[model samples]
Target: MVAADSTMRMEPAWRVLGCRGCGSAIVECALVLAKIPYEREEADYATKEGRDRLVQLNPLAQVPTVILPDGTVMTESAALVLYIGGVAPELGLVPDVRDPLRREFLRWLMFLVAAVYPTFTYGDEPAKWTHDGEEELRRTTDEHRKSLWRLVEGAVRGPWFLGETPSALDLYVSVMTRWRPRREWFAQNCPRLYKIALAVDADPRLAGVWADNFPA
Candidate 1:
C-alpha cells in the first residue's frame, strides 16, 4: 500500500498506546499522515496490568488509547479520528458532526468495524459465524466482505464519498483494506475502492504513513 521506504514522523505530547498492526494502529497511521503531533506506545493488551490501565481510559478496554497532554483521554478509533479532525477541521479530513455525511460516514465506518472487519479478522471457526464448519464460515465471511467492499466501491459517485474532497473515511478505508496483494481478490473485484486506495496512497498528505507497521 506504500512505497518500500516511506515513514511516519511524530511530535511530542500525544501518545498512542497499542499494537503496530491492528486496526487502531491503522488509525494511528492516519493520524501520523495528517501530521498530527503524536507518538506510539505498543502495549501488551493481553496482560492484566495493561488491560487494567487501558480500561481506565476506555471502559471497553479497546486498543489505541490516545492520551493528550492536557489529560484528555479518548478511545474508539473512529471517534479519535473525529476528535483529531475536530481540532483541525480546515483539513477537511472529517465531516461536520451536523453534516448528514457525518452520519453516513459513521454508519458506513462502524459497519466496517462491527461487521466487515471482525468477520474477516477473526478465527476461522464454525462457532464464530454460526455455520456448520470452519471452511463454510470462512467462505461466508470472505463473500460478505467482498460484497461490503463492493457496496463501498459503488457509494462513491464522486471523486470521494462526499463528492469533492477526500475524507477521514477515505483514509480509514485505505489503511483498513490494505492487505497482501491479491490482484483478483481486491484489484479486480473491488476496482473502484482499490483505485481510491491508490489515489489516497499517492497524496503527500497520506504518504507520511507509508512506512511503519502498515500491512503489505
Candidate 2:
C-alpha cells in the first residue's frame, strides 16, 4: 500500500503523451501515485502523426514526454518521477533528500533505469548494440537482465521495494515486469519482485492507470 498525504499540494494541469505499455506509462503511474492532476494523450508509435508529435515535443520521439503546468517540457521517466515527488513531498513516492533511505532509493532507481532498463532497449534491437550476431547479443542481454533482476530481488525488504510503502522503484519494476522475459518468467526467477509487481497491480488507486496503459 502507498502512504497518503491529504495535504500535499499539486500544480495546475500537467499534460503527458506516451504510448501505453511503454516506459512513458511509468510517468503516468508516478503522477497518479502523487495524486497530481494531469491530462493524457495516447501516442501511437506505429503512426507518423504520433511519432511526429513526440519528436516535436522531445526531439527524441520518446514516450513519456511531459509538459508541465508552466509549459516546460520534461523527458526521462525516472527524472519525471523525482520531479513529481519533489513538488508533492508528502506523497512519499520518492524519499526526501534528508532521509537516510534516500540513498538506497536512488541506488536502486538508477540501477533500474541505467542498468536494467537498457537491457530491453538493446535486446529488443540487437543491431543497435552490434551489427553482427544480433541473436547472440539478445541472448546475452536477456541473461544479463535476469541476473541483474536476481540481485534486485534480494534487495526487496517486504512486499514493496522499500518495505510496506510503495515507492517509485516499485512502480518502475511493475512496468518492467511486462517487458523483457515477461511477467511469468519474472515470477519464476524473481519471486520477491514478482510479488511487488502483484501488489502494484492490485492497488486500487493505480487500477485506472494500469487499465489505461496495459489494457486487455
**lDDT, each prediction:** 0.66, 0.84
The residue-by-residue lDDT of candidate 1 on 111-196, one tens digit each, is 76777666645533456456557777777776777777777777764577666777777776676666423334667877767766
Lowest lDDT sum, 10 consecutive residues, model 2, at 1-10
Task: Give per-model TM-scores.
Answer: 0.74, 0.89
Alpha-carbon error at 174 in model 1, in Å?
A: 1.0
- lDDT by residue for model 2 (9-60), tens: 4665778887888987788888877777678888765589898888888876
Off by over 4 Å in 1: 1-12, 44-61, 97-100, 124-136, 180-184
- Candidate with top lDDT is 2
Q: What is the lDDT of candidate 2?
A: 0.84
- Candidate 1: C-alpha lDDT: 0.66
lDDT of 2 at 11: 62
